[model samples]
Target: MHPAPSVIFFTVFSGIGFGLLVFLGLDTFYVTGWTAFVFFAIAYLCAVGGLIASTFHLGHPERAMKAFTQWRSSWLSREGVCAVVALVLMGIYGAGVVFLQVHWAILGHLGALFSLLTVFTTSMIYTQLTTIPRWNSWLTPLMFMSFSLAGGALLSGNVGSATVLILVAALIQIVLWLRGDGALARSGTTLATATGLGHIGDVRAFEPPHTGTNYLLKEFAYVVGRKHSTKLRIISIVLFAVIPVALLVFAPFSHLLAALAVVSHVAGAFATRWLFFAEAEHVVGLYYGKR
Candidate 1:
């Protein structure tokens, strides 16, 4: 799968936004007009911004609305629907907190549920893809969920929550990478199986499919070589997990460092998200000899 910048920005930015909304709904901190303003701004910027960015991936951005009708079977559609529902609920909830300074307990819980569901649906968009074995695991969704919660905890300045969630998310990410390293090798999908040529004899492409690149090669045959993957993975872990968690632990000594932790984590999230797309093995690539 291609790792378009728009999609990466959408996932990391909106993820943090929705995560913040989840914590806000829990009444995890004091709700003041100032706090409400800051939190809502962050949430909407990421959530709505990410949603808008997603359209760029479409050939016809104007027709993206058609996706809304396929919620029954499409994770992408479900993600859009859940996002809209959560945003609307959060909007109303924001109004009460920012204006009246009163908490609508029920609305808050509903908003949080939908917000988390939105993240889950986003993860499912990748997890449902059978061709990408690494992403096909349950750990994919868990990774997304953990990142959201951890980011939310950091943004809220809740050291206790951020510490625990970041550690868990970090650990999960490490395991994801460790396991994902072998996903391609264990896939069992070979040129023979793909073309159902196993019974006849060993199947191998004697020559290139075509002399020139086509849509399949450009879109599905993306290959982030093994050596590059190793370097990116190391960078991702340091920025996404190690640095932020460590900074948060020491943040009590210096609020400045706490702020830096969040900034670094967000930056690291971008790198990791990029790997999420780059590392995926699209089965169509097998036809292109990418596998």
Candidate 2:
């Protein structure tokens, strides 16, 4: 995948927003009045902003609303539906807390369920892509959900829980990278198999598919150097998990320190998300002898 910045921002920020809603729905923060308003405002900003960002990737952004009608057959549609439902439920739940200081336990729980579902659907958008073996794994959804929960916990001020979730998410991140590295090969998808010419003889492209670049090459066949990938992985893990955990455990707890941790984690998330798309080897690239 080309890893457009819009998609990366959408996944990371929207995941965090939904994660925060999960906690709010569960009454984990027990906030009220102006405090509750602030929390909900941040959540909505990230969630809605990320959703809006995704529209830029569409060739016809104006037609995006039609996606919601295909929920039965498209993960993208399901994600849109789930996001709208979650936002509606959360909005109602948030209103009660911000205005009346009342905790509508049922609405909160429902909102949380839908919010988590939205994240799951978002992950499925990539996970369902058989063309990208790296993302077509159970670990994809797990990684997405874990990071969401971890980010939500950090933002929700659940230090103890955030520390544990971050550690778990980090472990998952490492495993996802390891597994993804061999996914294409493990799937038995090679140039020979792709063209169904294995029985005839050993097949190899004698010449380039075309002289110049095309959409496939620019979008699905983008490549990253191994050395650069390694460096970015290390940087992502450090920012995403290590520094935040270290600060939380070793340093005296303070608001300043918490803010730093949040910043570091979000930065790390961005790096990892970038790598997620950049490193993906779409099977379509095999036709171009690129993957």
User: How do the predictions measure up, each by TM-score?
Assistant: 0.95, 0.98
C-alpha RMSD in Å of predicted model 2 compared with the true structure: 1.0
| Candidate 1 whole-model C-alpha lDDT, 0 to 1 | 0.86
Residues 1-291, model 1: lDDT tens digits: 778888998899889889999998888987769868888888788778988887777789988888889999999999989999999998999899999998998999999999999999999999988888889889999999999999998987778898899889888888998898788668887788888988999887767767998887777777755558878878887897889887777546476887789888998888889988887878878776777
Compared with the true structure, model 1 gives a TM-score of: 0.95
How would you encode candidate 2's per-residue C-alpha lDDT over 12-129 as one tens digit per residue?
9999999999999999878999999999998999889999999989999998889999988999999999999999999999999999999999999999999999999999999999
Per-residue lDDT of 80 in model 1: 89
lDDT of all predictions:
0.86, 0.94
